[model samples]
Target: MAGETRIWTPIDYEADGKQSDCLRLPHSTDLSAYGWVPIPLVCIKNGTGPTALLIAGNHGDEYEGQIALSNLARETRHHKVSGRLVILPALNFPAVAAGRRVSPLDEGNLNRSFPGDAAGSPTQMIAHYVCAVLIPMADIVVDLHSGGRSLDYVASALVRPGRTAEEHEKLLRLMRLFGAPISFISDGTGGGGLTTLAAAAQEQGALALTTELGGGATLSKAGLALAEAGLKRLLKDQEILRDVAVEPASPTRFMTVRGHSAFVYAPSRGIFEPAADIGAEVLGGQIAGRIHFPDLPTREPETLFFETSGLVACRRAPSLTERGDCLFKVMADIDVGPDQVSHA
Candidate 1:
């Protein structure tokens, strides 16, 4: 009881049919001393089998995952499911409601708050409930994501390499089955790596998968279609969905994000003029883009170059830039082999 989460849900996770409810996270504010934030939750159970925990809205501005999970929650019924399906379409309800990447309540990034505290902020409480409660009940976990307002991604599915070779293989198989255009084998060492939901799930022995569908704080038609189709295929293949007719997975290119060289950052605050588009293949030392000072039109624009040769997997969406802002992220093809399955 020392580390128990304060959030409580009325939905019975073991029930035979579908149940929808809200996870009540306490928010003691001036307006209402007894107020609670309602985080939407849907659980579908049919007998006993493996459980799949699907989540989205870790970053609120990411639209693809939010829409996909919302559709799944609305469309799916208990009769169609062979096992259990737990859907958390908007995990960070505060951020999702504000349409922001971080929660306005405490400016907390849900993705960076795993293994969270029971006595922490609202975001941490939600994260604690997820890792301590939901993840343990899952055989597999799928977290959908996108670039949000700052960047645009070339639709890709990512998996964190497991601790053992056998576990790694299982994760790889699931990534391929999702059938995104690109399969990324991530070492999970950047941007709050170990604190991510994927990492928490992996540490708990649950096969975890994440995706980057699209970005720019808007819905992408292509990204939405891929999310819908891939989710159905994954569920059916895992035998969680019984009667769904899912199409065979298409070919996915294997890739990985190497070292710091894979990223391009803005050197100073200026307007960014990109030289390469998202998904463009670039060589090392290639001119990535230029930073222009609008105030000093007479001065020359400072050009930036790529440090690694690879495909541009993500690019900054906004033209206005700031110092140290990530302008580009490049990904290289992974040489699939027995020994090269996991990156160090």
Candidate 2:
């Protein structure tokens, strides 16, 4: 009880049928001392079966997941489901409403705030609720994401390597089912590590998957389409949506993010000129981009190079950047052995 979340929901998760409500996160502000922030929730249940938790908008700036999940919440009906479907279109409501990557209320990044404290900020509270309540009730969890405001990414699905080989294989199968053009494996060192929603779900014995659809704070048509189609396919594969027809997933190129070398960061504040686009193959020491010092016209532009060889999975969207800002992230191909070819 000491570390339990303070948030309360009006809808009963155990009850059958379709229900739409909000998780009331207590916020004692100056306008209304007892007011609560409403985080939208949708639940569709039919009979006994596995439970799937679909989430998006972990970062407010990411639009693909939010749009896809919202459409899903509206279109999916209770009768169509054999098990339970839990949809959270905007998990971090404050950030989503503010159109920010982190919550405006507490400036917290939900994706980096998993296994949160009960008495933490609003974003942390939401994270805590999901980890303490929702994840335990789920058999599978999907957290949709994109590059957000700063970066643009090749539409991709990702999974953290599971604790056991069997678990890792299952995660890979689910990732392939999502059907994104690119499937990458995270070693949990790229960022967030165990603090991410995927890690939390995995720790709770649930298979978790995440995606990077598009970015620059704009809607990506390809990303949205991928998100929509993939969700349907995943639901069908899980036997949750009995009435929907889903096509078999296409082949996905497998990749992996090696340590810090996979990232290319700006060395100084300046305008960046990209040397490679997303999905471009480059070798280590190749010019990634040039940072121009517009203020000092005479100064030679500093050139940045890739530290690792791979495909450019994501790149900064904004031309102007600060020192240490990630300019590009390269993901190398996964060397699948003979035994793992069947999954690919």
> Candidates' lDDT values, in order?
0.90, 0.89
TM-score, prediction 2? 0.96
The best candidate in terms of TM-score: 1
Task: Give the per-residue lDDT of model 2 (tens digit) for 162-258.
Answer: 7777888888889889999999877566578778999889988999999999999999999999999999988898999867977778899988877
User: Which runs of model 2 end up more than 4 angstroms from their true locations?
Assistant: 336-344
lDDT, candidate 1, residue 251? 93
- What are the runs in model 1 whose C-alpha is more than 4 Å off? 337-344
Error of 2 at 168 (Å): 1.0
- Each model's backbone clash number: 0, 0
List, residue by residue over 249-324, the lDDT tens digit for candidate 1.
8899988888787899999999999999999999999999999999999989999999999999999999999999
Checking candidate 1 for backbone clashes, the offending pairs are: none
- The TM-score, computed over Cα atoms with residue i paired to residue i, of candidate 1 is 0.97
